[model samples]
Target: AARIIVIQKRAAGKKWGKIMVQWHPLLTTSIPVEQPKGQGIKDLWEDIRLPGEGYYFREQRFGNPGQTSMKLTERVIIAFSNPDDVILDPFLGSGTTAVACKRLNRHYIGFEISPEYCKIAKARLLAEKTLWD
Candidate 1:
């Protein structure tokens, strides 16, 4: 449906990087003012040439073999989009994209080829700790 695609390096030695995002209809990326002091989303793509750390779950990361790092995904989502924006992930691996979207208050539609991965991703999303008290 929608499309908000982001291509990133898998790692330093890896021959190929990963195409991580895909949005629906049409999505626009805008740089906003009033950010966290010196740090702004403007610098989000500054180090795009480097390798992504992949998911933060480490040993806990399962189901999908190619899980993008949570921090990297979150950073991209925060920079390229705003809260309430919709994200589309065609290859919904470990659901890192969905997790990032949820944490950032963005809507998402994730598609996965494997039902097993889907279930695993769902559990991970539900297991996420809320920011609210």
Candidate 2:
């Protein structure tokens, strides 16, 4: 299994100014257990399987509870880009783009809306050990 470090915090007080942090591996990627090809063209996605074993993790994302993590977004970036390549995500929900880039060996910049989500995104990126090394 591949390990990922997780950092969590709670917004405190009425202003939510105080935050405490804890670090650990909240999740790990297991070796893909199965292979399946769902409908339509597979796009540029190779490691991401569609509605089966390899695809099972898609649902863990922020908006799509059953879809997958922004981590998959990292895999896509890695497949298409080189280290230090500039990758951008216009709607950077949950900072998935930045987090994934940290893991996939790329340089990325993104924009996200929610302040809380930004915290999570930043935490995710900061916790990552650069895949480049």
Q: Pick the candidate with the highest lDDT.
A: 1
User: CA lDDT, every prediction?
Assistant: 0.65, 0.52
Candidate 1 lDDT (Cα, 0 to 1): 0.65
Off by over 4 Å in 1: 1-59
Error of 1 at 102 (Å): 1.2
Window of ten residues with lowest summed lDDT in model 1: 19-28
Q: Clash totals for all models, in order?
A: 12, 6
Candidate 2 regions exceeding 4 Å error are: 1-47, 50-71, 131-133
Per-residue alpha-carbon lDDT of model 1 for 1-133, expressed as tens digits? 3334344444433334665432112143554434566665443243433244432344356756677567667766766677888989999987989988988899999999888898988998999776872
lDDT for 28 in candidate 2 is 35
